[model samples]
Target: MTQIQPASFRDAPFREAQFMPVTLDVERRNDGTVILRSRVELGEYEPNLAQAFTKTAERCGAKPALAVRNSDENWEYTSYADLKHSVDAATQWLIDNVPRGGVMVMMISNGLTAATMTFAAYAAGVILCPVSTTFGLTGGDHVRLRHVLAKTRPDVIVLESNPKLAAAVVSCAGDDVAIITTDTQTVNRRAFSLSSVLATTPTSAVVKAIANIDPENTVSYMLTSGSTGLPKIVPQSMAATAACGQQALVAIGRAADWGGVIVDWLPWHHAAGASVLRSTLLQGGTLYVDDGKPLPGLFDQTIRNLREIPIAYFSNVPLGYSMLVEAMEQDPLLRRTFFSKMRLMLYGGAGLQQHVFDRLQEFAVAETGYRIHMTTGYGMTETVTGCMVIHYPTEQVGIGLPTPGLEVKLVPQDARFAVRLRGPNVMRGYLDEPEKNMEVFDEEGFYRTGDLAVFSDANNPEKGLVFAGRQSEEFKLSNGTWVYGGSLRAALLEALDPLVSEVVLCDDDREFLTLLAWPTAHASDQPLGTIVNRLRDFNRTQQGASAIIRRVALLDQPPNVDAQEISDKGTINRRAVIDGRHEIVSRLYAAEPDDGIGIV
Candidate 1:
């Protein structure tokens, strides 16, 4: 065999080789699936979360891994040793409660039943179908529960021990699946309580689960309630979760008292908890659970928590940042307290506006005598959390390149072929939906990310990637000229400043592209004409026939909620907006000055 020497960049022969520039939204190809042949100790992995707790109990598992609100309103965390014993006892009780391998309807309040046992089941080696207790509150919730029951067909439905809530669960489950209650009491529901399960005979029944179960063992299933169509059951695996944990930890750097104290209230059913919690747990680190949302009334509490934690890394959807910027600009100690611990402040799960980034830069420099790293990460649940994370300095606004394990490909999308990615972090498939799964991954096995991106610094590929926009939303006019809604949106936002929080580009079949500008609710002081004039200025920056936006409206209505699928990250759901805006879009196409959008 021919001897091949190691590859090094220092060699002149490799100096000319081109690597993609890094940007906030861009993706780059870098080989494929990773195999750790060299035992370089990349780090520990709870490949099967089932065995993770046992491993942690032997190591740094908290005295109580499960947390609960005390009578005094303080949140207390449970240690690992006790949690393990509880899980084992619970497993033995559940086995006697329901048949082996039978599905269990897991739904209750946002407490332990929602967060812990649910996770415990996966670790305890049972199939747990997680559902929302909120589904029983509204007509929509009932309808959703019906849809879920038909699909999962669980042998047992577990309701939180709250008596009132247990009654709802029993009524929902009916005579079909047996109901098991936790801690709370429910009327008319014949069931076993988790507390009773914990007090099971033979307290040491041994809850140790088989760690090497088939990857597709169907541990946890989450339904996607996206606006577009019927919900999807996104089945999760040990591989994907473990992969996501490793990927995020490598990039974010995890260590106790070292990593950021993420004070987010994002739902655990989504990717945020999966990626964030998995990474933190793998490092035996701490995760501060926040109870508030990003809304105005809730902002102060979050700010207080944020100030106290000294976050090393923090992320919020764009709207959250817009508000954070306001609160940050108003306070001095908050800035000192914030930047004091915040090393990397990231934004994602939606499109980020430039003005928010600028405000962050101002706050960081003025208070800390340092610049905070403002960045964005892009990935789908299928892609194990995030495959690409751009940690560009506050000054740069682009999403950066992919980490070492991923690969990207961009085909024009228009007459100009654009870039995209194919990587291992990409999902295996959407549970049992082979037909749907085939479309997501190309023949080469790369996940077809619907996002469009450009080179942050094309001259040097390694610099990073920039988020261009949704490829599906980019279009052209009768002039045979292309309108990059994303590129143009970026330009308009840069010029419009912070007052204009979000913009939806219109005019699909019309002559010039239009906009439905959602001004910042706090930006009431800015006049409509000023924002319009700024749009005109932004349009002027474009050259040739592509420059457009004959009319613009500042919408009083916030972005669509259920009907319009604005991303959880706060990016405008272009397709949802265009679909729902049949009339609003019509007026914009007709150049109706009374656009659904308006200036502050």
Candidate 2:
């Protein structure tokens, strides 16, 4: 038996390894403002994502690349060679149907078929667009999808076996757009079956076209969550996408002899999922598709799958990890298997509560006699996935240092610094948004992140940056004091653990702040008196209005997904929740507060 040693960033072996090199340029202006830019040396490897996948497949020809549960509830495997072949076949079909520069929008489940089509779109040189399937087929959700369809004007639209999603895409699609689905029973005469197309062989001409694809061209057009407004299309270049995958591979620090395994259910629509997909392919690792999400009804599926497969590494949002912690606490076998082969655990998208972090450490020590390294990074769709990563092992909550091929600049913004980034991994600009794009970057060419951050220590950058809310999310009180929502939310969640699932403060031009709290499952089980006492204790420890949650109304329903109150990535949109639930908020701030409202 051999012991698997984890990779450390400070090790001599790691420091000497030749990955891509990024040159950082710094300039100081007379006005005391500084600018930063990072340029990558591009001669080390192939820039095209499909070409990189092809090379990886050649290296791991017979290795299992994709695994999915079949209709008979058996795990079906697709080898690297099989995956490449399927992608090529799908690419041929896409070439015949969609012209160059055309958009191909997909509303599909996370499975082998969906993964195959995504790569095929890349190989065929069409701009692939992925939208959230969590958007149910009604009201605002439906309207939002229609807006995406209208904005992208996709030449081809692919839907999963889901009838609801198929109906939504069909209704929104233009008459000339080709509608495709995996459901054989689909009644639409014009809608083509994906299975039939995948069975065909690639023509020589189609193969030639695939080889002719520009390595630096835009391969994907990802849609923003539109939590603030309508969704914007971000065009991500092939080089940028590939750079992210390579950076992740370098961070994982697995030796060449080491292969990896993952059981992931993150939606492919988000950059997080794409990063995992690319890294898996780049490393020639096996990916087991889990059809479950972190939500109550679906998380059982994730647990069932994990019971069968042992993963080398895993990543999920804070809510998912919180739920998993509860399950692992009660089930020792689950905990043992979870930490058995795992190298690292990663969480991102929002601030992870400290209690959740502590619980994971507790379970890790109990199961494996050692604490598993858990960390997270920070980035958006604009940066492809992550620019700053915790490449080294640490339990602290900072976003970590900038990865190779990227530069992070902190500029003064209000009381905090705005995090601006420049790198090969960053997107060129949003599609059809020239003016908006112009406003995002400075003369020195750094993209404004709209995020505020403060370094853990001013003198030491190695300590990393702490997230202070988004500039757009902050609001001013009537007394002209500004409130940072992210900091407040993180503090409240940490101090009042197991009581609140989420908190959104409403204090714009108000005398005192009010909060709309979404209670955790544990909190609901407790008596109202007990919950009020917890809030009281938390408030007494705080100093000012921004820190104290004055009045709170526990939400009767979860944050509405359709109304953009909560994103698919498990992040609450504070502005959307406030706007959509104004009536409930008004009640919380009434002259005579409602009986349901609790005051500190």
Candidate 3:
């Protein structure tokens, strides 16, 4: 077995911080399956999420719990004490209106109001469901939104006072369901304003409702990204949610001690973003709800926000970091302010390119003379967030190990292992879909993640696992050679660095591999010959028919969110894109490639 050596960062200064000690117990079964679990116990955790909020309120009363940018571009903060008051009032309203086990669907973005209602629903023993704003506001038939409404049968829907959202909900939701908004005037339906809900006087019933919350009961219904099919509802129990937070706290250490200020734009509808929100609240840290996204014309806001906030922890997708690296190369102040107090940096949603990772470290060393710890994790919505994370300091990019209270089962599949998770953090099953639930879990009750991984160092299990690709996305060529889409996409992105923002592989049962890519803003101006030369360089280094690309097409159009081509987390659905752009794929495979297509 060839040993994998850790990347050398001898010149980079080491900034010290406490992280969970690495400890693992491995069990290799006769069936060629390996079970890995942390020997460190989960210890004690607060199962009631409301109690976590209440504790933070009591401990950090005057501190800013949440902040959002105003129209003037200045941040407006809501103090913990004020937030607690609003939560209690909203809890009272929930108890008086919705049933104890009823569902409250929130269609709003991350903000003060969203945070207040989230904790209120927790306190009131109501299951809160948050969906992507794009489902309601983006131009489509609202199929995903309609499907969610039909599945959960929510008792109430909370949203901003936008007529578009209100009309969408009114059309899909039942008449019996109540509509709650920030303002009722703009809503065509009879809705109650959030101010009225916050004005309710808390009674003893509010306390009783809090006391009645069952940790084992479903507290939230998180929607899957629907990359493979229609979105499925994953029922998250309070125990699972609390367990995930506790696991993170144990693994990553206390964020409060690490300077607990975060600026994030990840939508709360997804697991990673929701984990950020919950973990911040549990740690008694302040969060700035960023309105800016990683897209063009919007990331400027993120840069502006970062200039003012000296954050300790930062997280974003790889594209965001790429953009940041470009901006920081030109602006020295942005780099200084960003790296000044940052202790840890995290990237997720997709595999981060090695060049992006290296560039970020270079910036960190240049700014602070030390490398900020960067890591990634492996998990899904079914697990409520990441159960396996890279907590240790290493230059190697891989999902480190299972957190406390979690067990990972690795079943061999081809050259990789199919990762299955069994943990307190794992959800019981999908909401109201028994057949689908039965299909997802193994006989021993592990959630089949459908993700593939291999040991980064096969001789050293402690080095943890590196993501190989999605088992579902791997397809065989007509020559019977299997192509791993995920890892290939990562390689393609890295090889074509600063040229293509995203690429989709398109050679399932074809003679040769081809790709559909969206070019970076800078690369868009380059001549077609430039892209062809890069592909030639890439193809020269690659061996075998499954690895080399024969043709490529650079698309001017971005991935359409409405068509399910891209998810809320900015991950492209490979199947969706191939099907949606069938015409383009055919042209790339034509007997004579068009002038627009680049051939190597």
Top lDDT prediction, candidate number: 3
TM-score for all models, in order of appearance:
0.79, 0.90, 0.95
Write the residue-wise lDDT of candidate 3 on 1-600 in tens digits: 121122434366666666788999999999889999999889987899998788888999999989998888788998889999999999999999999999999988888888889999999999999988778887667888899999999999998778887778888888888889877876666689888999999998877887878899999999998877779999999999999888888888553242278898998878888888888877788899988777667789889888788887888888788888778777878888998988888888887777667777777776776888887888888999888889887878888899999999999987789999998999888888999889999999998998999998988899989988887888999999988878888888888887878899996899999989888766867986787788889889888988888889988787877777877667788888899899999999999978988887
Query: Tens-digit lDDT track for model 1 on 1-600?
Result: 121222221111200111222322333334422111111123555566656656766586544444454677476776656655666666666656665566777765444445556555665556777665555543334566676777777787777555545545555564756666645345454556667766866333334344444544666666664434555676666666666566555554532122224555555656665556555444555566665556547567667666666766777777788878788766776778877756666677555676566567656655554555566777766665666666333246666556555656665544333544654455666766889887877676766766777656656655656777766656778767777776777777677767777777776656666777777855688777777787677766667656556677777766654443354334567667778767777666553344345432
RMSD of each: 8.7, 4.6, 3.6
- TM-score for candidate 2: 0.90
Q: Model 3 Cα displacement at 339 (Å)?
A: 0.7
Candidate 2: tens digits of C-alpha lDDT, residues 49-141? 777787888899999999898999899999999998999888888888889878998877778877888888888899999887755355444
**Model 1 segments more than 4 A misplaced:** 1-44, 61-73, 97-111, 128-149, 156-175, 178-194, 197-206, 223-227, 254-260, 391-394, 410-424, 475-483, 507-512, 543-547, 560-572, 575-600
Clashes counted in candidate 1 amount to: 58
Candidate 3, poorest ten consecutive residues by summed lDDT: 1-10
What lDDT does the true structure give each of the candidates? 0.60, 0.76, 0.85
Ranking by TM-score: 3, 2, 1
- How many angstroms is residue 150 displaced in model 2 relative to the true structure, after the best TM-score fit? 1.9
